[model samples]
Target: MSSIIVTNIAPTITEQQISEFFSFCGKISTISLDHNTAAADKSLVAKITFAKKEAAETALLLHDTKLGPTSVVVEADPTAPAPAATADDAADGELRQEDKPRSAIMAEILSYGYALSDKATQKSVEFDQKNGVSTKFHSFLKDVDDKLKVRERASATDEKYNVTGHLHDTKSTLSRYFEKALDNSTGSKIRAFYADSSKHANDVHKEARRLADMRTGKSPADTPEPELASSAPVSV
Candidate 1:
C-alpha cells in the first residue's frame, strides 16, 4: 500500500467526507486524520493509504486541487529520514559579527536593550514590593537610571549603524516621554508604568528573537518563544 498526505483540511471537514471523496480515485485501505490538539491555530492533516500504488500516484497529481472551499495540498508520505546536516551547512551557520546582516545585527542589539530595560523594571517592582516606603524612592530612581542607560546604548548603536531616521526619532521620543513620566510618577503609578513597559519590552524582544531564529533556521516559523521564568516576589 502507498500513502498520500493531504493538508489544509477545513475544520468543517470530517473523516467520512474525506473517505468518500478519495474513494472515487481508488480503494482506501486505511485513513488517519491528525487533529492538532496542541494549538487551535494549526490546520488538520489526513493520511490516506491506498490499496494500489497507482492510486497514490493519482492522488499526488491532485496537489493544489480544491477540496471544498480551500485548496488542499497533497504529497507522497515520507518513507525515509531527513538527511543529516553537511559540513557546508555547518560552515554557513557560524556567522561572524561582521558577516551578519546589518539590519539583523541592529535588531539583535535593540532586543538586548529592550531586555535590559525589562529587567530593570522588573527589579524596580520587586524592590518596591520588598522594601517599605523608605527605600521605594531610591529603588525607583535606580530603575530609571538603568532604563536610561539601556536606551542610550541602543540609540548609540542605531546611530553607528545609520538606521532609518524614523526609528531613531521614535526611540528618542519614547525614551524622553517615558523618562518624564517616570520622574513624575510615584507609589502605585510607578509600579503600573514599569509593569506595562516591561510587558511591551518583553514582547518586542520575543518578536526579535523569533525573527532571528527563523532567519537562522533554528526554529519553525510558527514556533513560540520559550517559556519565561515565573516572576517571584522578592523579600529584603
Candidate 2:
C-alpha cells in the first residue's frame, strides 16, 4: 500500500538486483523500474511498493545509500492526483493533460535534450575540478561529449520535424530520420542515445494512449509485476 521512489539508480543495476536489495527490509509486492522517465540522464527510477507501510518507512532509511559506485536518492512516492484538464484540452479532445499537441511535445523533447547535454557538461566540469582531470575524468568527458553530440542531433531532428509538423503519426518517418542522422556514427554510446530517445518517445506515446483508454474505461490500470524471489547480490 506504500510506495517509495528510488532515483539515481546506476545504469548497471537490474530489476532483480533491486528486488533482492529491498527484500531484506520486508515483503516487496512490486518493483517498477521506469528507465523511460529520464533516458538521457543514464539513470533508472524505480517505484518500490511494499506490502506493509512500515516496510516502506524502513526502506526509506536506505536514502543516500550506495547502490553502485554512486549513492542513490530514495523518498516516499508522492501519489499526486492527475491535473485537471483545461478548456483547450477538451476542445482538442485530449482526455489527459499529457496528451499535448505534437508540436508542444516536440518542443518539450528538444528542451530535455538541451537540458541533459548541459547537465552532462556541468557534471564533467565538476568532476574535473574535484579529480584534476585524471584518466578516468578524460573517459568521463568523452562519454559526456558523445552524449551531448547525440542529443544535439536529436534536438535538430525534433526541431526540423516540428516545423514540418509531419511526425505526429508517422513512426516510420521518424525512424528513417534518426537512422539517417546516426548513419555516420559508429560508436556504441551514440547508438545508445538514439535508441534511448526513440524508446522514450514511444513510451510517452503509449502512456498517453493508455491514459485515454483509462478515461474511456476501455482498459484497466497497469499493474506492477510481483517481486521475484531472489536474494543474490546484483552484479555490476
Pick the TM-score winner.
2
Give the lowest summed-lDDT range of ten residues in model 2. 227-236
What residue pairs are clashing in model 1?
none
- Model 2 regions lying over 4 Å from their true place: 80-236
Query: lDDT of candidate 2 vs native?
Result: 0.44
Report lDDT per candidate: 0.45, 0.44
lDDT by residue (92-138, candidate 1, tens digit) is 32222222122222234332222223343333334334432223223
As a TM-score, model 2 comes out at 0.33
Note the clash tally of each candidate: 0, 0
Q: At residue 164, what lDDT does model 1 achieve?
A: 28
Candidate 1 residue-pair clash tally: 0
> What does the lDDT read for residue 205 in candidate 2?
27
Cα displacement (Å) at residue 57, model 2? 0.5
